[model samples]
Target: MSAQKRLVWPDVAKGISILGVVLLHIGIGVPEGESTWLYQLNTWLDPLRMPLFFVVSGYFSTKVLQFTLRDVLVKRVWFFLVPYIIWVSIELWTKNLEWQWVFGNEPLTWRELGLNLVLGHNMGWFLHALIMFNLALVAVRKLHPALAMLLSFTPILLLPLNEHIFFIGKALMYLPLFFAGVYFRQAITAFVDAVCRLNVPALMFAVITYAVGFFSRDLWNQFTGEVVLPWYLPGMDYMGSQEVLLLVRFVEQTFQLPMALVMAVAIARIPYVSSFFAFIGRNTLPVYLGHPIALTVGYHYVQIVGQWEISMDGERLVNTTWFWTFVCIILSGAGGLMLWSISKVPGIGWTVYPPSLRQLQEMVMRPPVLRSEPCRD
Candidate 1:
């Protein structure tokens, strides 16, 4: 395979991640009683979604240590930070607007918004995590790569801080996976390549592996009293301690990684499916940044639908729960893509391709590069 073809799977995986995220958020607006399918689907794929994205991101960042500190900071760190600041601001403003409109009260003040931005208390948290992880990697670059990976897990020791500093806890949770991508890039690539050429039996084994991981998780959840277990397994009503839950989560994600790779390669083998998702994957920056805004607005409409009472033969009717749920999902994905298109215009492009204050000035003074796109990697 050509280099480009070989590289297509990560983009395809990213396409899946962004879409799964959008689906999860859209499902949140659905009424609990009516959300069974959405809930189950999102829950089953949870391990694959963000984990795959982070691993791919880490794989791309494998060379960060080789770059000058300034280049890493300016080009990569600032690249994500600038957008995180701008969009988190927009997210806060729109949320404040919603609170005022819906409840006739503004719960978030300018002070609170500023604090949230600093702490990253919003959906744009993935970007915030990217900033911290990159900085963390830079700080440890002088250490042996394995030692750095080991140190990344030390963040888990700060589980207590999770209650107050949510983003820190989350970044710590995924940091090891990011490090894995950095140190194990060769092994991961070879594994993915091998999976892509799988025959039917091998493919079935891959599917069975994924199914076993998810099913075993279901059994674990039952053991922890989170869900029902198999009849043969004794029903142990154990409320899992925090440490145990964390361990299980890591274990499940470990099982999920290879399956996600296999699935991505499987998708890439199909021509049109590969092209469509890979396009989204390449443009994931806009989708990931814009989808929350779209979903938030979409949720406002969904809430309005929930309150909708139609008079049918002088009786009240409040149906269409599933209908609206599907609608919101479709529209949210479309809206995010629409924002992606809007971001192509020069001046407004900064909404997606946000530059630091210095880069902003330089970008304006210089003419655009001919075929330049944002670094999808």
Candidate 2:
């Protein structure tokens, strides 16, 4: 679809999702053993945030399914792979420097790099995982689209993969929701539309779903941490008990997805709010890439300036106040905007934000020059 003709709601949804991600990251950055209202809020919204992002990604993937495999791969390379590699390298380098400064350790080794590549570590792992997911989907769709979707669901119900593998596990965990967006596009669209119309029943359903999901999350967190699982089940000795894990998954599948969708739709229906978020949504790429750096630097700066003896282990923020959370948010937004500005530069920008596949192809396939004049000889 043309840019101007594109749907607004998805962008609004994305805008909201990215903000959620930022807030979640900020919450996580708070020192261990510290708790705040902001952190609790982030925990409540966790199930909805990333799943919503993946679903939207899958929904958009439909647009490219008709392209040749070569074209699709090329698009993925430019849009996701290139940026992922660049950003991951940058992130790792900075992290290595930080570690070295703090502990006088050696830089990351080749083995570490290889393992990270395999596991898709770092903040840019989402982009790496998205590339893999797109390629896998493309391959599966070749057999049959329905079959591809059917296969995606298997991972959701299966036992969780080792969390140490990080990105791989996350990709597996989220695959079904992503494919649901692809296969159930029409239904999702209709549902969003119905909710946007402020259908009273739909609103009520959304509110109730969100409440249940929130409550379930609280219970899950409690059980996983302090409260023991009440009943013994097979694999209770595992890192995450199977029965409790299943219940958590059930909550995600049943309540979180619908709540996220309804919230997105409701936001989209509001004229001013939708417009503001849509702007952020449209520019999420730069924000996503830049925000981590911003957060990292901002946190350190705050520590140094405030002379707060906060532990380097992320044990606690200097002051665990709502005002500090607001400051972090502002810093993140400013950092994102700075990155966006950098991405507009002519030559250097391409390093941070590669050209679109179409642009790259156009540059490669420009018209051959016509020999208009005879040879000088």
Candidate 3:
């Protein structure tokens, strides 16, 4: 068994990954039918995003729950469900989206809301997928990790990988990543330890994996078209869904297990980079939420500074694929820096995952000392 050791690159990688996601979201208006340089960057970075998140999430599997299923659900509620509802509602309201129009709802039932929540049918889909993914860890322990992955993976048959609602679809999609986090944690530790040794063969293997994966993706696109590219994920056309999922599992473990280990070892071996990223990793939530907000804030800032394009109501200029990419990085960094400030405050430090206003009102009303000012001499 591997003793618990901190893997620090995840912070910097997550910070980078999360920011990349924001940039990709900002890149929404770019045409999607063909291979472009922007698209390639998106794909290269895309694999890291969720897989890394599941890996980080996996590390805490035992840390979070053990005895009761209720405990698991409760923590998920506080961290995921509650935040998702709050944020999605905020997104919909701010973007002037009518919930009625978006979901085509005439009568809104809790059942429908719950379905929407699980399916990630709303704006906060990442968080939605997160809820189901974490729940999978707690639910399926009787089976071997590989068997659990296979069983959980069955939902891919019924649901398309684009994104789906059934619990199994999510379970299978992310379960492998999470399992790797927990089960192979020692493997990861060993890999990192080996990386600490820094043998030439290990580094060469890492490079080879990157090359095969990258070129395989390009080759898939060139030969089969974008539709059939990535013939080994939840949604590749060449193989059946299960077969592809199995292949993706092999590739991820083959590549990511070592990649995360080697890269993490490389980063942690460095003193300054480790310290900086670890601090950011500890404060991951704020940057995740604040990044997109900051990008828009930056876009408005640029506008005020005269570099802004005058976008007519139907025509928007701030969302070009290239420009918005930089915008997201700068804004996300700004948000991280700002969060570093708020985190310093006494008695108000929980804003990173801000509680509901109802919760806040109660906290304020029950305060021990009012905001009473002292008289100075």
Candidate 4:
């Protein structure tokens, strides 16, 4: 396949993943009864959503591996770290302001704030973990490829450390996926192509597996009054024994990974859908950065309109329906576009989205000087 053609499916996959991420976040905020269709839909997608994103990210990280360590660092600084720090600072500031004004709570301590930033607290953790994963991948690949493969399992052993220290826990959880992308990029592409060729049967199988896994979790959660599966959501914390944790992780990986890949392949095969997703995928950074800001703005608007309320059960409630879910998605996309538009401005663009190193070089480099003798000649 040509280079451009090869990129189409991956971009489509990425677009689908980012949209899923936004949808998942929307699901997170809006609590629903277990019987609701929206609830089940969210439940079904929960496992596949973030894992697919990490896998896609990992697949792309292969390109980064070719760069020198200095170049890699520079890339991360402008593309990842700078944006991470700036947006994180803004998020923290806004969150604190919300706490004080809305909830009348004391502000976070300097130490607490510093730790959160360092740890990449909340939604920004993905970028933090990604930076670490890339750095680790670079270090490991310096050894033999086989040895590097072996090192990928180091995170699995540290599964207990998941969600513990700064980005370490999350990094460990997703590192294998990232490394899988790096090492098995060709294999994965072949697998996706093969699956895509199977067409209807492949898509059906993917859907069936996802539904089965979703309902299986729902059944377990219904019986236990808690989600027994290993889901990394806010309220669904895993406090089980080591043995249980291991089992949950096993079940989750086994079910989630295949479903995510299958769904990605299925989505990539659809012409119009793939193009839409590819567009979103190509511009994901801005979407990822700006969606939270958009959501916050929408939240305040709802609040002002008396549409936001706290449920008696202490669950935060907004007057939301399926219609509003679509609205939120549109708003989120709009937010990303707005940020992207702002990024085109001359002086202040870097604050929203950092400039590429090539762009920076072009901006800073002086024009070549022509010698006087050459001019005379």
* Tens digits of per-residue lDDT for model 1, 1-377: 34666689999999999888877776666555235577578777888998899998999998887776786887788778767888778877777777777778757777887788778788888888888888888888889987898998886556555557787557665889888889899888777766766656556666776777677667667873443322222233332355356656776776778888887888987989999889889988778777777766766645654566322122333445565566677777777777687778878777677657676678689986699678896
Rank the models by TM-score, top first: 1, 2, 4, 3
Each candidate structure's TM-score, on Cα atoms with residue i matched to residue i, is: 0.82, 0.80, 0.67, 0.78
Worst 10 residues of 2 by lDDT: 231-240
Ranking by lDDT: 1, 2, 4, 3
Q: Candidate 2: deviation at residue 227, Å?
A: 11
lDDT of 3 by residue, 1-377 (tens): 12333546556555545655665755652233123366567656665556666676676665543635676665554566655675454444433323344455465555766666656675456676667666666677655767765655555564445433444444555666776676667665555556666777777777777666556545544544223324444443464444344445435443544564455556555788777666666766666655545554455444435554432221554534345555556777786567556656775555445455557679889959669789999
* Candidate 2 off by > 4 Å: 1-6, 32-34, 143-145, 156-161, 207-239, 242-247, 301-307, 310-324, 357-377
For TM-score, the strongest prediction is 1
Best by lDDT: 1
Better of 1 and 2 by TM-score: 1
Residue 3: error of model 1 in Å? 2.3
lDDT of each: 0.75, 0.70, 0.56, 0.68
Consecutive 10-residue window with the lowest summed lDDT within model 1? 228-237
User: Which residue pairs collide, candidate 1?
Assistant: none
